[model samples]
Target: MRLKSVLAILLISISATSCSLYNKLVYRIDVPQGNYLQAEQVAQLQNGMTPEQVQYLLGTPMLTDPYSSYTWYYVYLQQKGYEDPEQYTLTVNFNQKGTVSDFNLDRPLPQQQDADIKPLELENNKSWWQSMKDFFSFS
Candidate 1:
């Protein structure tokens, strides 16, 4: 019995130190939060879209102004144990009549680096198919 107890103590001490087996035993997961808007979904957004329509298309905004109902915010965050964190923000403003006035899809947080931000837009307010054609067409 004493020999068994000593062996147990030795095994516990071995696992307490950093080792490949220890690392595998401890699992870390990638975390993704908030509205995960795809590029295709964002391109579908347009002026005069109703709140309900917007919500249906893009799921839901992460934040909204309490003082004013005209603005909505969609924020995305991704954290990975082995890589750098990523964040995205989209701000949508509506008219008093509750129609989408305009939106910014590439707006970055103040602290985030500006290297990867790109504006998401459609030429002439065209749909996805039309935009794809426009991209392929030289003239």
Candidate 2:
């Protein structure tokens, strides 16, 4: 019957559309692979701090110049599927005495107003089922 054929076609169309919709709505876990540093921690750095102190406050440097022991680099990168990757770099130069002589941070230090700001949402932390539910939620 034509009605049966039409119903079959409609069902097929609905299934196809639903499959595409689900694919689009499905959340892919963000891949984060690198050192991550907080603005507050970077701001705590001060001139004349010893290398040991710097290492204590902030973790080990990501990269150090092979030829020069005076320069140290702290690099951070975060990759998220839905958002732009976040990156930061800090460079520290030590004096002959092995104390920090100067340093530079790629991003500006957080101000008082920024202290209350929250970090970006980490989608990888959410379960796939939760993400699916959130994807379909009205709010």
Evaluate all candidate structures by whole-model CA lDDT and list the values in order.
0.84, 0.83
lDDT of 2 by residue, 42-139 (tens): 87899999999999988889998899999999887766666777777889999999999999988863344766888867497997779889999997
lDDT by residue for model 1 (6-69), tens: 9999998887775866776776899888988666678798999999999999888899989998
Residue 46 of model 2, lDDT score: 95
* Candidate 2, superposed: residue stretches over 4 Å from native: 1-24, 109-139
Q: After superposing candidate 1 on the true structure, give the runs of residues whose Cα lies further than 4 Å from its correct spot.
A: 1-27, 107-139
**Superposing every Cα of model 2 onto the true structure, what RMSD results?**
13.9
Q: What is the lDDT of candidate 1?
A: 0.84
Q: Which 10-residue span in candidate 1 carries the lowest summed lDDT?
A: 105-114
Clashes of 1: 0
Model number with the top lDDT: 1
